[model samples]
Target: MLRVMTPTAVLLLAALPALAQPAHLQPTRDVSVTYRMNAPAAGGAPAAPQEMRMAFSVSEGKQRIDPPGNMGWMLIDRKANTAVMVMDAQRATMAMPPATVGAMTQGVPPGATFTRKGTATVAGLACTEWDVTAGQGRGTSCITEDGVLLRAVTTPPNGTPMTVMEATQVTYAPVEATRLTVPQGYSPMAMPGGAGTTPAR
Candidate 1:
């Protein structure tokens, strides 16, 4: 899976205190959000939503991605704004360069505003784009009338416009898991220091 350094990711990396839920929201939420990501072209035909499931977490202006089937973790740090990926699968471990996530959160700060860069066509849908060029992090997202974020693009210093990420078939509800708990038989592998984070945080 490709990594995307998004503003949502940056906010997570900041690890800001969790705020109160909106007045109308349910007291307890088992929110289940689906992100169907696609690159420009990945050789094979684009896959379906039923074949994909992903989670995006933004803490203190950082981004973290947890892919399906692999016990791997991808963390994007805010201040440094670089991406660090830790891959642990099938008894083997792999790590992505540390500079990746760091670039995403380079210059963005809380309450920083972005302007709509006018409508641009990404995958053939009308988009309301925005940007913050004063710093390294660039914000670009297209949302449907139903409030579904259909497409988004983020460019850190090391990343280019070519590294676009589009998410389709998004759904957000809630989950029942109270805390981050490892399975009984699964052992925690020694991941690269760059990307691993506290399970529950």
Candidate 2:
């Protein structure tokens, strides 16, 4: 005799495909988030945790991070898979090496897998937590429905999980296009150990 499927079972079957894919790491629309960065010392030694405010914004598929202090800013283009640093004082831009691009792009490492956990509230907004496993190690990321990363944690091989960054505030608004793009007529800067300017655009 053939078995019949219940309505709930049918609905769950239809949702399986969507669940297989990981949550969106970048914001789908214009939004800004201020995060408190907690970085561990080299070699995982115990040290005072320094807190700094990083202003992040995403618009039209491009992301920008205004680092703490007057260290300038960084621009990332997901489509082009490139990250560049814009030094306003020097009026120069420097392309980030390919090795570091993965970390800069929404904290999700390349070739990583995600398993959606229960939901949580961060920065006064609802988000879904995802347990991520990658070649490097395992971690978790809480992401908003609109695709903003509210908080992220990481664990190295044979190490404990540590909070890398967590959003302290979130704002949904329109970001000016110019803020995400390189300023007009800004020259490229030569990176250390290399000669010649990297194109920024």
Candidate 3:
């Protein structure tokens, strides 16, 4: 005996695979992002935008954090574990702090994923709060109802209550600067992953 398939059943089966796949969130680009991380304060220093001009960018799904420092140009590609801490005409340090550096930086991880919990409007922009988890850790990334990370709540493994991570600022404008390109006479350092790389400065 041959079994018959219903059209309803057939369509549902065809859609199952696509439905199972995670949503694709296009990373933000060509924008300026100011990231601030404040710790349990007993005089802990809060993160500030490096005084040097910084432009955020993404390529092939990897995010790069670039800033010009008094020493030279500081470019950190957390995803790639690559860094360059330079000083003009001085010995360059190829030894970057490590992956602990990534515990900072802004925007979503190139490969992290999230699920929408619901919707809300803030500062007149409609937003969505999502429950997010990544290699970086577990957190909530709330995008504008329009679907971009506007706020995030990250929780530590030992159960530190979620710390708020808000986009706080954004604009869909192109960043202008002839070069995010590294200059000549600089050293390359591989950032070590894990606790070792958390930079004190």
Error (Å) of candidate 2 at residue 49 is: 5.9
Q: Write the per-residue lDDT of candidate 2 for residues 33-126, one digit (tens) a residue.
A: 7776665667877656433333334435566766544566777676677777777887878777675555444343458687878899988999
| Model 1 residue 10 CA deviation in Å | 10
lDDT of 3 by residue, 34-153 (tens): 433332333433444322233445542223233222444444454554443443345343334433333333345557665767876543456666666656556555454222444445
| Residue 100 accuracy (lDDT) in model 3 | 31
Candidate 2's displacement at residue 123, Å, is 0.4
Candidate achieving higher TM-score, 1 or 2:
2
TM-score per model over all chains: 0.42, 0.73, 0.48
Candidate number achieving the greatest lDDT relative to the actual structure: 2
lDDT of every predicted structure (CA atoms): 0.38, 0.61, 0.40
RMSD of each: 8.8, 13.5, 16.0
Top-TM-score structure, candidate number? 2
Which ranking of candidates, highest lDDT first? 2, 3, 1
lDDT of 3 at 192: 40
Candidate 3 minimal-lDDT segment of 10 residues: 1-10
Instruction: Report, for all candidates in order, the number of backbone clashes.
Output: 38, 0, 6
